[model samples]
Target: MTNNLSVVINSDAQQVWTMLREPARIAQWHGWNADDQEAEINEIYFGPNVVEGADHTSLVVDGGDVFTLKPVPTGTEVSVTRAAIDHNSEWAAWDEDITQGWLTFLHQLRFALERHPHGKRRTFFFSVPGTGGSAIENLGLSDVPAPGDPYSLTLPTGEEISGKVWFRSNHQVGLTVHNYAEHGEGLLIVADQPAIADVRPDGGSLAIVSTYDLGAHQLDAIRNYWDKWRAENYPTSDPVH
Candidate 1:
């Protein structure tokens, strides 16, 4: 058996295309959970993660499907035309699972990346699925490691983060994010060590770190600081979005 579906996103063609290729973003719309996302792009030919020096997301399970993606005039054309599906023979039938899941994740990706676009920095967190650590989710301070602390921020990712205005190097800000469950270290794996700038989509210089090279002290600061920043700068996430 085979399956294919598409949804037109209200975003620029380029932005839609970019999200299709990003495993992190793709997993959100396609993976099991919205709060925790992890998927890597891969090549079917060799089951390789990298192809021609670039990476792709793939899920090749026994009796799984291979999905081929492309950008078409209509939208990002995703063809399930490739891959073998065994239904009960190879894998369980998860049609509703696939249809609703991928479409939703793609829509969110369209909204986020299209308007914001790159050249600016953005960060998101993905927790270990079903790991309901109070500190991890920031559900209540009673369970949090350093409640009522400054320079710490809890993110959607499993990474507990923290940052501080460095007293040295002209107050060059520093940050740390910890991915305890280790799903691609949240979004930190992209690019080099956290990039710091005064870019003002969030008003003035809010330090955005790449989370790749963070340690304990740095993670502490992000966890402490996130609420402070959200309280002061932006609105909290929508209950639904």
Candidate 2:
């Protein structure tokens, strides 16, 4: 019915409060589908077009709940004591979703406090054939970053995901794997000829990818192909990554 979430943000309460007041900043790490619409006044692309870290200047992460933040000598105390009817109802399907959402948001807050400029993260999910066709459900690596460690990624824009990836060989495809970290909103890693080719992020490029609507059998294959390269070139040395 109600949940209480709080964290000791590395930055002062004033900085955290400033970020919360910004609709766009809220959306980068916590907005739902509300930030997809191309608003009239705000004119921010929202709703399905909602990318986690695209631009929080407007809004995207309005979870039907209103948050109240207070300052503490140590850091800040953010409380979510009240929310919309939908968030309070038993029909809430994403109880766990909120958990993930809050953790991500706090991470972003911490990042902004530590670094001069704030960063964001977006994570994508998809599946591939374990043996041939049975996709591995929840390998537990969907929301991670480090490889072989059940990793996930986020970009400066938003999150990207593909639950079922069709397996294939030798194909040229431009895709992006959303990475999650303190650097920025999301890391738009292109899915080009070289899957997981360690491609550099072209921040100037206007191209974007959304994590919710992506699907492909070749998705996992691409990751696998990337894994192969990693195995060959960046072999494990001390199992520390």
Q: Summarize candidate 1's per-residue lDDT along 46-103 as a digit string, tens digits.
A: 2344232133323232224444445556555443322343456422344433433333
Q: Which stretches of candidate 2 lie over 4 Å from their true place?
A: 1-4, 31-64, 82-91, 116-241
* Model 2: how far residue 219 lies from native, Å: 15
Per-residue lDDT for 1-241 in model 2, tens only? Answer: 2223445655565566567656556544343223342152133323343334333222233443434455678766655432444656653544533443443344434444544234432333221221221111112222333321232333221234422121111211122233222222222222111111123121111111222222354334433444443334334311111
Off by over 4 Å in 1: 1-4, 10-17, 24-36, 39-84, 115-241
- RMSD of candidates 1 onward, in order: 16.7, 15.4
TM-score top scorer: 2
Model number with the top lDDT = 2
